[model samples]
Target chain A: MLRLADVSKRYGPGHWVLDRVDMQIPPAQSVAVLGTNGSGKSTLLRILAGVTRPTRGRVSGAPPVIGYVPDRFPAFDAMGSLAYLVHIGRMRGLRTAEARRRGQQLLERLQLVGGIRTPIRALSKGNAQKVALSQAIMVLPQLLILDEPWSGLDANAHDVLAEILDEVVRVGGSVVFTDHRESISGAYSTLAYRIEEGRVLAVERVAPRPRGVPMAHVVLADPGAECPPPSRIDWREVAGVAGVRSIDEAIHVQVHPAACDGLLMTALRGGWSVAEVRRDREAGRLGGGDSWAH
Target chain B: MGALIRYNLAAVVHGQRYVAPLLFFGIVLTVFTVNDSGPLANIYVVSASTLLVSMCWLTVTILNHEDPVRRSIQSVTAGGSSRVLVAEVVLALLIGVGLTVVGLIFPILSGSHHWDGSGLAAGVLALATCLFTGIAIGVLCSRLVVPRTGYSLLLALVVVIAVPLTPGLPPVNPALRLMSGNRPAGELLYPLSGYLVVSIVVAAGCIALTRYISVRRE
Candidate 1:
């Protein structure tokens, strides 16, 4: 178990960011820290990840190697996504062959389009988020900390991220993440720790998959010189393809993972590139642009 | 530590900010030492001082290459801010070593000055003195010690200009005095070695302070 005892954080004698907070994080469980912005959620996550040391307190029994994914991955890395993940894997104690293998596996599973070979600087927000999530998971860290992990993920990517979290817990690794609302992280986390006014309010248990059934959302490249923008939709009964709509000159199609292959193949066959494939499987959120600016 | 070193190397290479100091150092050394009959010790002194100042400028870029968000990601991945800060210094110093190599060899290859084994040894010591002194000044003015860029540049300019002007205050000053008198390498052994030790102490102090501040700041 990882524990924080009497932990406190302050910036130069100002108001407490986190005050005398005490908590225990056990393995094989997913914990979500819920708070609005500036509620000390990020500070708590940083301390748990060992990136920022608490001003005064003890963090004991932390895993030797902890993985951290910040709110947004920077858009200036020189290496492509695959290479960067491999480098991260090496630092986490994987051999070169093992690191490369695992990195490729994670990227494929996440369905990151054109992400493997493109420099991170060229990647869109949703693609960069995929890389960020993949880097942490590729290492298979026993302790994983993510800050606003869903900020830039699209519908299909969202579902994949949830599945990744479940795998982390299933493997007996702990997942600790912060989100502004319970509805955002509620579907994946097993335990909830809420932060209000720089203090841990209480611990609440979250039921598994309490959110609704997940639907796949595929966002395709904007129609332009690449492909003419479709002004109207004619195909209503394409198997697995649900609710086709146009937003910002791009087409979005909803599907379930179990029946998404046919639509994906048809899109590829039509010379249209897939910009993002994410899952829209959260409670009360569907069909919105997940690509935030880098 | 090796992995951290490798990661910093990749950033430095991508950032391409190092080329400015390196190019400036090469040009300064070439114009000052090329086709001169001045004594070898004087030539080395010019190269040494030039290198010291260039390394200071180079250090700023290396340490600040990544934005804050990227820096936090690296800190978490590498395990702590201390390791990240240490790796930045080590990488800067490693580049300084390369600059020193070019400083030592470029003049000799140009065949502009008569040289000897003792002169070469003395030149090496003088260059080492300047290298460490420059690094100390750079680390002091970096984000670790001072957060704002305007202040960092202002301090760097003041120190680079002020340190050389104050005779006997810094090793570079005394080393300059030794070469100006056309002194033999034998006469310089004790003084240059002592100055190098002092410069190294200053660098170590700066590194320790920067590491402490980085670890505690966030």
Candidate 2:
């Protein structure tokens, strides 16, 4: 378990990269650090890693052990990936022979057995990242700190990395990681937070991007009434704001994406009563115009 | 203390892989004959000093750097006290003594009875000075560079500086006497025990400062 209380950090005495970040991570849990570029996601990771100090607050609780994987894995010349993992194992207090054996096994599991002896500097981006991750998980610390753990990984490698994460969770370890793309597939997260403007905006779930083509149609009551003009419809008033296409009398009205509730309310208030509303499940199907479909 | 020692030892052994063998070879060869001592004398001094300093720096810097920059180890260090950190520093010093013994054993086995206790102690002191200095710098450098590189570079810097300083010993500079507590000053003021006292003081100071600064950064 890890608790960050009133944590805040400032680089030059003024700008706070993290301000009053209060969080609790229970044992055997996983939390993803989400944010735009410069959103303080990495800064939070650094603070957790102890590489950077927080200007204020305290991090306390269980005698936390960490398995840290840095963003850029700087490898030495002639250093094999397997050898690297073994060294980390030894660092974490494993016997030399055991370290070596585990290192070999980790490489083989990651599909890196063939490249075990290859100098780390020579591996591809994804392979190098795997080497970095292998070192992080080798020790199985109480807490695993991973910065962009999924970067440079191919599909298969991604699965391996995800499995490693699942294994950590299964073994009663806590994981805090930062990633640009969604990596947790079909796994229910214990806690999720999105960082924006140096603030962690906690979300219950980060839904997947809508699949397939987007379809939406707005139904107007009184089938014989003529459709409202484009200029008068005020498409900008919608939240999801798919453009408003022509409304065919006694038939259908086309819309891109789903219409915002506010827009629907506005339409209702404007004396346009809705008979029905249906949204397209596919993402890109609302072709050729930015208007809402009825 | 044992955990810290283990961490340091592992990092040095593994991290050395990143550094080319040519670098070590060059360092050992260069340290050997950089002085006015004859070729054999130079060989002896360089070999002992190289191994001693390498082991010392490797142990000290890696231990400090890995913990401070690595989230796993950093949490432990930050969570612990200066006392624990100081224990780690002392362990490195002990290792320094061990390396000096190794250096002495090498020459004695090769049939050089000229290995004096005072000289061996002096070498160890010099090595200790370098090792502690490397650890101190590793603590400071972690603020600037990544953990692994920060420590490796700090060790490298100490070795570079030691190349010139280790060879210049008591003969080239009078300050060496201060390090050994062998000055002509009153024995009461600077007794033989003074050397150990000074070593402990410096090592402790470095450890505390490193711990304080690193925690502040945290």
Candidate 3:
């Protein structure tokens, strides 16, 4: 976990950029920082990344392997995309061969292999952003911090990055990012914070879902007389069951469609027979009313 | 720190900024060889001064290329700003020494006059001191001033004019005094030692200043 206490940043004698901000980033959580221009969102991220120091506060518990992507990638004009990624990977403590291999893999995943040998200065804006992200994930950092990571990415690349973030969280890594696009924040963020007048305030806590993937609602037969009660079962231990609730003789399990099979297997192993499985399409849809249908 | 040094060395080499300094040294050596009017010592002095300017120019350019903002990021990523600054300073010194060695070789290759081994050693030491002093001052100025290019160019110009004019400052004027043949061996040792001590102090002071400013701003 990363914690910030009474963190404040001021430049010279000017007004504070961040005022008494306190935040905790726990493992396996995705946090979204939101604010208007000059509202200290980037400053907050920088402090978290240790790229900047707060004037009168303390920060602790920063993980050793942190992947940070600033708003703009620094100009490594003389270095090729692959070389730059390799350099960053090496800096983050990867062995030379491993760094090279990972650099290749990240660029390929971002669809930037065609320009691997091209100088960073020559890459297009969106492609350059991909390079920036490639460096951040080269080491699969335990704590990944990004500032406007989705700003210049194309549609396909956007989905690719979302999947990567999801994988990072699934493996118990933490992600903290800031983005202006509501669609992005709404889709992947588990917690959101708003920066208002240099103060950080918890705005909303979201229960993240797999985007565009429907949820599965399963009904399981009541446990036999010798078996434990359904409520006594720890559904969280099931591979894909996100949540479990028992209603009368039936048990309702919420899970991603991909995890439906795993959920059924776990239920059967626990002495509960599976009765039916159906897609909870309405529960999976975002927003509400007619607006969501579109 | 090793990675930073390797990255910087590769960047400097691949960027081809070293070319301009080498070319400048070559031009100065060729001009002296063609003219052949002045004393051999005079030729060496002129060539050495040109090398000093080139070394300072290269240091300033490489350091300025990474703006303070970028440096801050590098500092945090690399664990601290001191490591990054040390790597940069070491690269600058290595480049300066390499250029000085090449400059010293030019006079020997020309065979215009018999060169004493001690005199050659003293010349290289003096040139290195001058280069170190220039880099320290240049880094300090680059951090304090905006439009780094303008300030760096201005600093280079000042060093070129001031080093030859003020012969009392041991480090800055050693090359001039040594080339003139007026100073005895005993006299030269005192100034050379002073130059070494002053160089260390200046480099340390500048690095400390850079760190202080960087931390405060961050």
Candidate 4:
């Protein structure tokens, strides 16, 4: 088991990011860490991934092979995605030929759109995230840590990510991630906790929103003038957006009640304004109706 | 270890960060050697000095090539910060060997000189010392120590200029004074070897300190 004992982390003269905290990360489990912005979720993952040392704590039994995907994947413009993957794979202990081969396979599996030769900086943000995920899973690490892994991924890539995490647990490797969506944490994770005021608080599984009922109909504005919104191919990755129909440049979403909060959070986080939300007491179970489809 | 070195080398090379230092190397050697009939020892001093500044610049180039996010990912895979730092030092040394060879050769081609096996051997020792000294200062002034690019560059330039002028300092000042007489290569061998030893100790100490500080910074 990987574990932290009496972990307390504080920056100089600042508040304790984590105080007298302790947790166990057993193998074969998927763990989710949830917190508001600045709650130190990233710091905790960094310490657990062994990328950074805790201010005060003992961490032990960390696996021999580990993979990490940073929140913002640095898209180095100088090298292509395949070349970057190959370099990272080799650093993770794969042979040159194996690294090349494995990188090709993972990119294909992740459904990256750009050809292998495209520089990562030129690829869309979602594609770069795909590349980041590919590098980590290429060698089948004994431990996997991802920060905001679902951000920028589309619906298909979201499913692919779920399958990948399942594979990690099937091999008895542990997985940990930090995300804001409770439904995501609730759906996939065996254990989940939210950090508040430097403490990890266990989140009881919220009973799934009214079974089969389309609990909410949400209308969200298109992304602002700053950047183009994600294309349709990848639009629903955040919060399992089950159905999307465009009405006068606004997105009309009929979502399962359980995933409604996640969808709203993701939409807002993506810079889309939530214009309106209706209870939709007259609607049926989501994802089952062509009525909600464009 | 091989993978780490290759990755860093590839990053710097592809980024074109090494161009400035290599260009500096080419220009300095060309200026110091062309049309000079000086003794081999005097020419060798110039070669050694150029090698020092060039190595310092190159070492800093290689170390800071990766941004923080890329570095953290690599660190996670490499298992520790020290391994990454060691790979960087090893990469710098590999490049240093190339510089040393260039230093040993270009002078003979451009200038008149009397040289033999002893002269070649002393050239190797003197150049090796400069390589170590350059790496020491480079690591000290690199982002690992001084993070701001302007300050880092300023610190590097100041140290590179200051070290050679410090009297009796191994490999720089001592080598310059020894070469002042244009002595026979065989006569300068003993002192050059001693300077090489001191330079190695200094380089090793700097590497250790850098490794420690980098680990803590994360």
Candidate 5:
């Protein structure tokens, strides 16, 4: 957990860039700092990353290993992407071999393998951005901070970053980034903070969308030899059944609400005893209303 | 700090910024060796001055290559500004010492002049001290300016003004006098000691100032 108390930043005789902003970042979640240009989004991130010192107040619980991607990556004209990542990994305390290994993995994961030998300054902007992100993730940081992490990424790279952030949160790490594009932020973030006039105003937390397809729990008695093999059966022919997973004698069917009845009828007609029929609540509500009502 | 130093060394080599200075030093040595009509002391003086300027330029180049914003961020993530500054200063000194060896050895290798063991040692000492002084001034100037061209020009102007005005400063003046072969033989030990003390004080002071500026700027 990271907490800030009355943190403010101002230049010499200038208006406050950050005005006594207060914030908290809990573990296992992704938080976004949202605001317009020059609205202190980057300033807040810099402060959190410990790059910029605040004029007043205190910050605590900041992790020793922090991964930060600035809005603009510095032009390391002389170094190649892989070399730069390895250099950063070493600086973050990884051994030479480990740093190189992780650097290779991150470059491959981010689709930057082709540019591994290319000087950073010569790479395309999007690929350069991938290099920037790779350096940040070289070590599994306890707290990750990114400023407009998605701005220069292509579609595939964008999705890859989202998946990486999900993995970070899943492993109990925290991520704090700023993005003006609501579609991207809304899709990935668990909580958000809006900066207006240099203050952070809390926005309502949006619960995560349920993962995977809505699976219908179907329990059936052992099928006799007359029953067709589950793999050979075309479960899609049953109305609303999207897919089927058979575990021993029980078949877990993924179905749309309209096809739930059809799925049960097909099973009963096949002489399979129906032990129970109910929507998988853990799969999240499907299209709202009483998802389990049959 | 070790990693930072390694990274800086790699950056300097890869960027090839050291090429120009090394080439210039080589050219200076060739010119002095070819033009042997002048006194051996005069050759030493001119060559040492060129080496001093080259070392300063090398310092400026290293600092200029470092992006201040990126460095600040790296400092925060890596540890602190002092560690980064120490790495930079160590890198500059390492480069300075390496170049000093080359500069001092060229005259001997070319057989331009012959000197006894103590005389050769004194020459090496004088050159090394001057190079460090140059590094200190270069670092301070690099922090004060933004563009590389600006700092290079600024450093040149400073050397032009400072070299001639060395008479007013004691230890530095002695070191310069020794390089120029104007000091008495008996005064070598005293002046060399003074130069050593002054070099340490200046380098330390400049490093502290750079750290303070870096922190405050961030």
Candidate 6:
């Protein structure tokens, strides 16, 4: 278990690049570090990697056996991929043979068998990223800290990374990774945290918008002809339809974030009719209809 | 600890690609030999030049190549202190042994000089000392603002030129001649013991400094 409490960092004494941020990741769990640029995402990862110093904070945990994958690939010029991995493994106390064996295996697994003997300078960007990722997870570290791990990966490479991460988590390892892309699935389901203006905010739950086809469909009424299909109207643009409550015969009831009564009253007066509407006072359950029901 | 030293030495020596160090070694020897110097002067030149070049090679190997700071931190976090220690020691040994061989190889191979026992010992010591000093210098450079290879090349160039220039100073050359102990080149070169002592002390200081820096900054 890794716990960061009251962690803060300031460049000089002026603005805090990272304010008092608190976070915890349980063993065998995976967390996504989400934030806009300059949100202290990289800084936080560096602090955990023991690269950057936090100005004021108390971090508690075993010097978390952390495997760090930096955003930028810092390649060693002369060494080949095989030599690099074995060297790192040996540095971590494996025998020369063992290190070499592990290196070869990881290289092959990452589909870089051809480049294992090739110099690092000669490798392409994707190949180099594979090398970097393998080195980070070479020793099976307990805490894996990755920054922008999926930056340039194609679909296959992304899948391979996901497999690697899944294996890490399966073995009771913890992970914290940051990425700008949000469409990457499984991030919302797992532990998610957002960094805004140097403050780390923990997201307890991420309720994803209804996927596939939302069963609780929305119907808009013209009160003149038959209500148009739910697909015809852009659900997002229509003022209160986004927070859909429920569906009745020809009426789509929605709970507006601010005041629902005004829009409902306007719709009623404007003769954009609601054939049926039932609003729960406290629960805010708006029973609305599907266009097919009429 | 001894295992670590050996591992570091092996890694350093073997870190090269397809006899790359031999390229630099040949260049240094060729430069002096191609000049007006005879075989005898060339042999001495080889010893001094190897001592100078080996240090620079070791410095780059430790800093830019392996990057002790990043490797050490990675290993520690990976729960492999023993491995990190071994790699470092092996690197140091590789530097020392590598220089020693390069220094003695050309002299013995070319039959340039018949080394009496003291001459051989002094040559060995000088090579070892130079290598040790290089490792120590590399450790210091890791902490400083300068890039590893650049700093090492600059230092090696200065040492190669400056050490020889010390004897050319008028008032000091006379006194320096007395303290020369009959071995003019060896005395002109720094003492081996001094290099060894300096390497150990400096390496230890560097390790401490790195740990302090890492913790303080973290």
Instruction: Give the top-scoring candidate (lDDT).
Output: 4
Q: Score residue A52 of candidate 1 by CA lDDT.
A: 80
What's the TM-score of each model vs. the native?
0.82, 0.60, 0.78, 0.85, 0.79, 0.65
Clashes of 4: 0
Candidate 1 lDDT tens digits, B109-194: 76567788888888888999989999989988888778999999999989988888897786778777886676688788788899
Candidate 3 residue runs with Cα over 4 Å from true position: A74-76, A206-294, B33-44, B67-73, B143-148, B184-187
Off by over 4 Å in 1: A206-294
- What's model 1's lDDT at A90? 71
Fnat of candidate 2, please?
0.09
True contacts kept of 3: 0.35
Ranking by TM-score: 4, 1, 5, 3, 6, 2
How well is each residue in A253-284 modelled by candidate 6, as lDDT tens digits?
A: 44332234544555555556555443433321
Local accuracy of candidate 2 as per-residue lDDT tens digits, A1-294: 578889888875668888899887787777778777778887888777655668888876744557777776665435567766665675567787898888888777777634788877788777877787777766777887788766676545655665677678778888888865432311324566787777777765434224344546566654233755422454433433323344554223444333335456767666676777876444433433232331
lDDT of 4 by residue, B1-218 (tens): 89889988888888898999999999999998988887877888888998899999999998898888878888888887778888999999999999999999899999887778888888888899999999999998889878799999999999999999988776677876786665788998998889899899999999888877876777
**Candidate 5: tens digits of C-alpha lDDT, residues A29-55:** 899888889999998998888887788
Interface RMSD of each: 1.7, 5.2, 2.1, 1.2, 1.7, 4.5
Which has the better DockQ: candidate 1, or candidate 6?
Answer: 1
lDDT per residue as tens, model 3, B95-193: 777777777777667646555665665666666676777676656655434345676577667865676578676556754676667554445655666
Give the i-RMS of model 5 in Å. 1.7
Candidate 3 residue-wise lDDT, A39-87, digit = tens: 9888899899887889989999998878778888766576798987777
Say which prediction, candidate 1 or candidate 3, comes out ahead on TM-score. Answer: 1
Summing lDDT over every window of 10 consecutive residues in candidate 3 chain B, give the lowest-scoring window: B34-43
Residues B1-218, model 2: lDDT tens digits: 45455544544455563244225534564544344243222334454445534543444444544333343432333334443455455655565556555554554454434445555455554444444443443344433233466555665566445533774432212223343343322222323234334444654665566677555644
Q: Runs in model 6 with CA error above 4 Å? A: A10-15, A74-123, A183-189, A207-294, B1-50, B66-89, B108-114, B142-144, B148-156, B159-218
Best by DockQ: 4
